[model samples]
Target: MSTTFWIIIAGAIATYLTRIGGHLVISRFDNIHPRVEAGLNAVPAAVLTTLVAPELLNAGPAEWAALVVTAVVSLRGGLMAMFLAGAAVLILARQFVG
Candidate 1:
């Protein structure tokens, strides 16, 4: 009914179509070249960096510190650990340091 609702619906449909189209195209490929595989593997990280880097640059010290800690912990931990550690550090730093 509302403009925001319609926008959300359109976004969901677009996302679904994009994913299905990618799957359909990839499934037809009998053999993927090494370069193409490398490019495909890089896509997620590239997209993530594009989404995160700008916000990170504008963040405060607490957020920066949390991100640094998360990055370090990511070497030894899973995604859940990184997320929890970052959130906890940010909360604590905001409460005590800020």
Candidate 2:
């Protein structure tokens, strides 16, 4: 196999093993450490903030409104709901505000 092909296979196998290892570790734990639990809980918010923070800093009004809608939806809804709400708000904001 080519070196690049071997690299890709190695990456895929590493990803699969890491995911399975997490499951195996969690299954053995009757209760996770509080700090570990807290870190896990913070991951989604941290990821969302990282994703949105740059856009927020540079956003025009419509983008700002869309982000606000997303935040609100995130509080009371799931990811898909928040995404849809944000997209809908963006569409409307563009149509009306532009």
C-alpha lDDT of residue 84 in model 2: 97
Expressed as tens digits, the lDDT of each residue in 20-90 for candidate 2 is: 98888887989889999999999878997898678767788899999889989898999899999999999
Q: Could you tell me the C-alpha RMSD of candidate 1 in Å?
A: 2.0
Scanning candidate 1 in windows of ten residues, the lowest lDDT window is 18-27
In terms of TM-score, which candidate is strongest?
Answer: 1
Q: In model 1, which runs have C-alpha deviations exceeding 4 angstroms?
A: none
lDDT of 1: 0.92
CA-lDDT, candidates in order: 0.92, 0.90
- Predicted structure 2, TM vs. truth: 0.64
Task: Go through the candidates in order and give the C-alpha RMSD of each one to the true structure.
Answer: 2.0, 3.8
* TM-score for all models, in order of appearance: 0.80, 0.64
Cα error, residue 48 of model 2, in Å, equals 2.7
